[model samples]
Target chain A: MNKSYLYLFVRFVVLIALQVLIIDHINLGGYINPPLYILFILLLPFETPGWFLLLSAFALGFSIDIFSNSVGLHTASCVFMAYMRPTIIRAVGAPADYEAYLNPGIPDMGTQWFVFYTLFLTLLHQLAFGILESFYFAEAGIIFIRMIASSLFTLVLIVLIEYLFMSRKK
Target chain B: MRHILAFIWKHNFFFLFLVLEILSVVLLVNKSYYQRAVITNLTDRFTGSINSTYSSITGYFYLKQENDKLAAENAVLWQSLKHGLVTTDTLTTQLVDTLNRQTYRYTVAKVVSNSTGKRNNYIMLNKGKRHGIEHDMAVISPNGIVGTVVSVSDNFSWVMSVLNKHSKVSARIDRLGQMGTVLWQGQNPDKGSLTDIPVHVKVIKGDTIYTSGFSHIFPEGVMVGTVETIKVKEGDHFYDIGFKWSADLNGLSHVYIVKNLFREEQVELSKQVIDE
Candidate 1:
């Protein structure tokens, strides 16, 4: 198998396992169910093409939806994050001119840039997921509360995982 | 049109995201009919397994609390049993006089999983289809009514917790006997509202509320809550009644599943009336 395909497959399996086995059980009070599986989207190769990102994000979220029974909430949120990833990367400036094969790593992108990148992506993903999950104008306040709680939790997990695992890989 | 298509081709990701978001919104809005039932069942099973694992892990920490609760409950049960036996002779005469009155039976089960913060929260019980737990059975904690069963598997069932936005129970005031519909406001799990009680009915704060038994799901006199506030809406004839739920749902570990023996017959009879 191609190295990229092999890498992507491993990443998919690891993320799904982590989400279902570990993160799903960490309720942490206040209805904060973090979707750490979005790390798969975050770690996609920088040059993986926009359509592929959109499709993969959709598939990742749809699979989670199938597992969590939340219908299309996760799928919608993941696609939104994938769509905004490029813009967010550009806004944060190219991570050293965006090398095609460069995986998103703290060492490659610097701690500060990676933090901002993960924060924005995690926030976007949580906001979309929370809003879609609530799906009621009357629930705007509760949705906001859930969004903030879930985003904060997801951000902490993303940063810890990046620092511990991806930082070591580099 | 060609230029638009070209622009769309250039911004395919953005278009795809928009389409997916729209599709999701449509699905959410049409939850009544287009809900993915199969997916829900699969997720329920997956969650059930995951929760069981976590329950085993956390069950260790909760052993002391569970033991204490059980001990306290056992004391109460013993006292009640003794009192009932002592009053048996007198109660026999009263029971014969009220032979036509309704009676309720309670079956106990532990709450395997519970959630309070979600817009549509649910609780899972250790008992299910094999345990005579059918759809629409009312679940009550030691404090008050929790919710009704929404789905059931062979060994487990999910209850739509009273904290959910969709929860509605028929309730009546204990003192005044004024009736209203109790609904979750989705703001606080400890509090809910009783709407449609006529303003003319005399009601006071702290009035006890119980199930009206109008619904096939719950039996009469199951504790619901107490009136915390009775605000007469300006220019409206109905009072906006606030209630403090009698059941401490967040702290609930064990609950009773109430099965109405006459539910099937009552439902069939009602359906016949509607058909006629």
Candidate 2:
């Protein structure tokens, strides 16, 4: 458990730094900056309790929000996605041996489940964040466009991270 | 209670989702400028619509009060206008004389009751001795003369309307400069007869009739009416001119009382002349 905790702490620091320093600054047409740090929440271990998972997601999102200069936007979206995570896993029909040691990554859940799960949560997070950021029905189209573009970008990056890290660990 | 607690604990993530979402919206409304603007604009629009509806529902209750305020403001304007201090630079015609000193003070009072259909029409004003209203003060609407105060009480005064048979106003034909007198004949409320103009003078239709200021009641040149018709009888010394009553006496709501500061002195001078 201590080793896992250390690993998660390292993962948190790395993903947040990557997102703030790299992903957030790279403006794809000025509105398509990927929310890649959500990978920390998405790849959390399957058997992590709800409160701990939410808290971890909040901490990661709050750091990103502070760095991005938008104080509550990312925290809200990330918390929503964290709350939806357990339901999504249950709906995906996890294997009988799903336990504390099993990370919900490509190596553990395979490419198909990982893609679906990450894409779904990334889309949800992007939708929440985009709407809250704009907060106007007149800008609904712009919000929709940003959500799609940023969700796709975040999904690609999350997939790449899962693939690179899982391959090396395996 | 325990079951409810169990349910909440069981769905603690759902509760957390609700709490966090509410927090986010609160923060967005309070801390964010753009989102707060949107929220406040929506709230203002909603409250504005509600307030308008409320005002519409109860607007009639304030109509009397509002009319009084407007009448009071008009009184102040009339005081300045009747004082004749300010003059336009463009036209140098001597049509309106400039009084070097302020000679008239004005106050507004609402018409509490009026009767135009009666032979002796009288209007009751909502102000009296306490409001500086006195008997024989001139009462005029925004358009023209309405009546003269006949009696006064602590909080009310009666005005003998210009449509009454006994009502008289010293007047003149503006274009001809012929002095005349306006008297209601106790018949038609819309028309008054302008008497005392010499029969040989031209009586043109649409010519304006104005107060001649001979009676010391009305100020000089206040419009009374326009000439509607003229009749000259055989061997009659005066032309009987029918003029439109410029004021809507029946619909009277607000009126100004012209208090002439020099009225008592002028009357005393006239009385001494009569005695001599």
Candidate 3:
């Protein structure tokens, strides 16, 4: 259990760092803003306590929000994503989804299941974030375009990160 | 009471989710406009250090390009100097009339972090309150207006970039003398729209825009941008004028924070005008 906590801590720092230091700096055509830090919540163990899941998700998002000078945008989206994670898992998840499976990566969940999982959560998070960030600022038509672009951009990066870790496990 | 306790236990997850989500939204709503979150102030100190460390390492990469830009700026300054006129033999008693006409003091700052791709973008500078940076001071790049300082800490200040949706600058068409408001209409960072110009006003393409000094936050005649597109819909009184921003927010590494000495006095005087 302690080892698992350490792993979570390391992943937390690594993901947040990668987000603020690298990902936040990339503004592809002003449409694709991939807040790739959501991967932290996505990779959490199924057994992670609900309260822990929400708090950690909040912390993860709050960190990004702080780094980017946005106060609560990431926090709101992350909490939403975390709250919906279990429901999403059950919706598209296999009957075999279990703690013994050692966290949900592409290897254990398979590419198809992982893609659906990442896509749904990423799109939802991006949509929520895009709306909140552009609530009174952006055009309605542009918000949809930004959400879709950002979702796809994040999806590609999440899959690549999972693959990199999956190969490392080998 | 027993049944209520059991129900609460059973729905604890949903309750926790609600509480957490509501708290997040509270933070969001409270900090939505101009209010700064107390939590963010703490976080800024932490992120500020980390960012400064990161920028210190990365700043080396931009040294060459930065040097070239500085050299070019220096050349422009040199051309305007009267050094070629030569000082005619020393020690003549000249009328010493020293008058302070400069109302703006500029403090140089290095951009440690910036974002342009997001709908609401912000920039972080290495200097802060200790460095004489204050809230609502106008920030400019070497080329043109960049943003305004929003939040300042002990050693860092957060700048709301012009690319931000909330950013609206009082603007004027230079040659035409027509007045409008320059704002980022979302999407492109390099472009912004100048609105409020009446349809009757003839706005030619490529006309330059400048700060109108209507708002004391920015000085008058600061370079804004050059007009790119002008469209006037039928029956609409105003023209939809799009202009290319002179400063590139995406590539900014250095900026100047302009502090107006008479800002408070100007504001005080203007406040009385409304009453009359």
Winning model by DockQ: 3
lDDT of 2: 0.74
TM-score of chain A of 1: 0.92
Residue-level lDDT of model 1, residues A83-165, one tens digit each, is: 99999888887766656657676878788887888888899888877776665798788788877887888888888888887
List model 2 lDDT by residue over B77-125, tens digit each: 8778635565555354354455366888889886654555333456656
Task: Name the best candidate (by TM-score).
Answer: 3
Model 2 Cα RMSD, Å?
A: 27.9
Ordered from best to worst TM-score, the candidate numbers read 3, 1, 2
A1 Cα displacement, candidate 1 (Å): 7.0
lDDT for position B17 in model 1: 79
Tens digits of per-residue lDDT for model 2, A1-170: 79989998998999887775445434354446688888888877777887888888777777765443345778888888898888787777686775676778888778999888888888888878877766557767767877887788778887887777686776
Model 3 misplaced regions, further than 4 Å: A97-99, B32-37, B82-100
TM-score result, candidate 1: 0.80
Computed on alpha carbons, the lDDT of every model, listed in order, comes to 0.78, 0.74, 0.85
User: What are the per-model C-alpha RMSD values against the true structure?
Assistant: 4.2, 27.9, 2.6
Runs in model 1 deviating more than 4 A are: A1-36, A49-52, A62-69, A145-153, B1-37, B40-44, B87-107, B201-205, B229-233, B272-276
Q: Score the docking of each candidate (DockQ).
A: 0.37, 0.09, 0.80
Order the candidate numbers by DockQ, best to worst.
3, 1, 2
